[model samples]
Target: MLWTIIGIIFVLWLLGFLFDIAGNLVHVLLVIALIVFIFQMMAGRRKG
Candidate 1:
């Protein structure tokens, strides 16, 4: 689920790069997604 969100956001970010539509918003979401991905990785590592 988390990965899905990250993937979707990443796709949108790439689309923004090509189309220049809502580029800023997509970039922000991409950053948020990256932060969440990092946090998830950290939590998973601790549990394992």
Candidate 2:
């Protein structure tokens, strides 16, 4: 689920960059998604 969200955010960021619309917002979202993904991974590792 987290990976899916990250993938969607990445795709959106790519599209935004190509179309030059809300590039900054998309970039910020991508960064946020990356952070969330990293946190999720860390938590999963600790759980195991």
Candidate 3:
């Protein structure tokens, strides 16, 4: 779920970087995704 969204955002960020589109909004997405990822990691959930 969250991982999927992160992967998609990453791909979009790469494409935007390669094609030079969206100017800066795509970078904002990258920053947002990084923050979410860090938060999720710090939350510390167990699957056992």
Candidate 4:
């Protein structure tokens, strides 16, 4: 579930990056997604 959400966020981020939309907001969102993905991975690793 987390992976799926992360994947969606990644695709959206890629689309935003490619299209250059939303200006700084897109960049901030991309960074936030990255951080969330990293935190999810870390949590998953600890659980495993």
Candidate 5:
């Protein structure tokens, strides 16, 4: 589920780059997704 969200965001980010559409929003979302991914990894490490 997390991976799917990240993949969608990545695709949107790429499209934004190529078409110059909603680039800022897509970049922000990408950053947010990355932060979430990192956080999840850190939390998982703490549990294990």
Candidate 6:
């Protein structure tokens, strides 16, 4: 679930990086993905 979303974001980031499209919004996606990753890690730590 989370992996899928992260993968999508990563692909978009790569595309934006290569093509220089999306007008800086792609970096926003990267930030969101990082935050999501951090939150998930924290949640997993709490659960375990």
* lDDT, candidate 2, 1-48, per-residue tens: 887999899999999999998859999999999899889899999999
Candidate 1 C-alpha lDDT tens digits along 1-48: 998999899999999999998949999999999999999999999999
Q: What is the lDDT for 19 in model 6?
A: 94
Worst window of 10 by summed lDDT in candidate 6:
21-30
Off-target runs (Cα >4 Å) in candidate 5 are: none
Q: List candidate 6 stretches off by more than 4 Å.
A: none
Error of 6 at 19 (Å): 0.4
Ranking by lDDT: 5, 1, 6, 2, 3, 4
Supply candidate 5's per-residue lDDT for 18.
95
Backbone clash pairs for candidate 5 read: none
Query: What TM-score quantifies how close candidate 1 is to the native fold?
Result: 0.94
Candidate number achieving the greatest lDDT relative to the actual structure: 5
| Model 4 TM-score on a 0 to 1 scale | 0.65
Model 1: weakest 10-residue lDDT segment is 21-30
Tens digits of per-residue lDDT, candidate 5, 1-48, equal 999999999999999999999859999999999999999999999999
Predicted structure 3: lDDT? 0.88
lDDT by residue (7-48, candidate 6, tens digit) is: 998999999999998978999988989999999999999999
**Model 3 per-residue lDDT at 4:** 94
Q: Backbone clashes in each candidate structure, one number apiece?
A: 0, 0, 0, 0, 0, 0
Give the higher-TM-score candidate: 2 or 5.
Answer: 5
How far does residue 26 in candidate 2 sit from its true spot (Å)? Answer: 0.2
Candidate 2 deviant stretches above 4 angstroms: none
Stronger candidate by lDDT (1 vs 3): 1
For residues 1-48, write the lDDT of model 3, one tens digit per residue: 889989998898999999998989989998999999988887766432
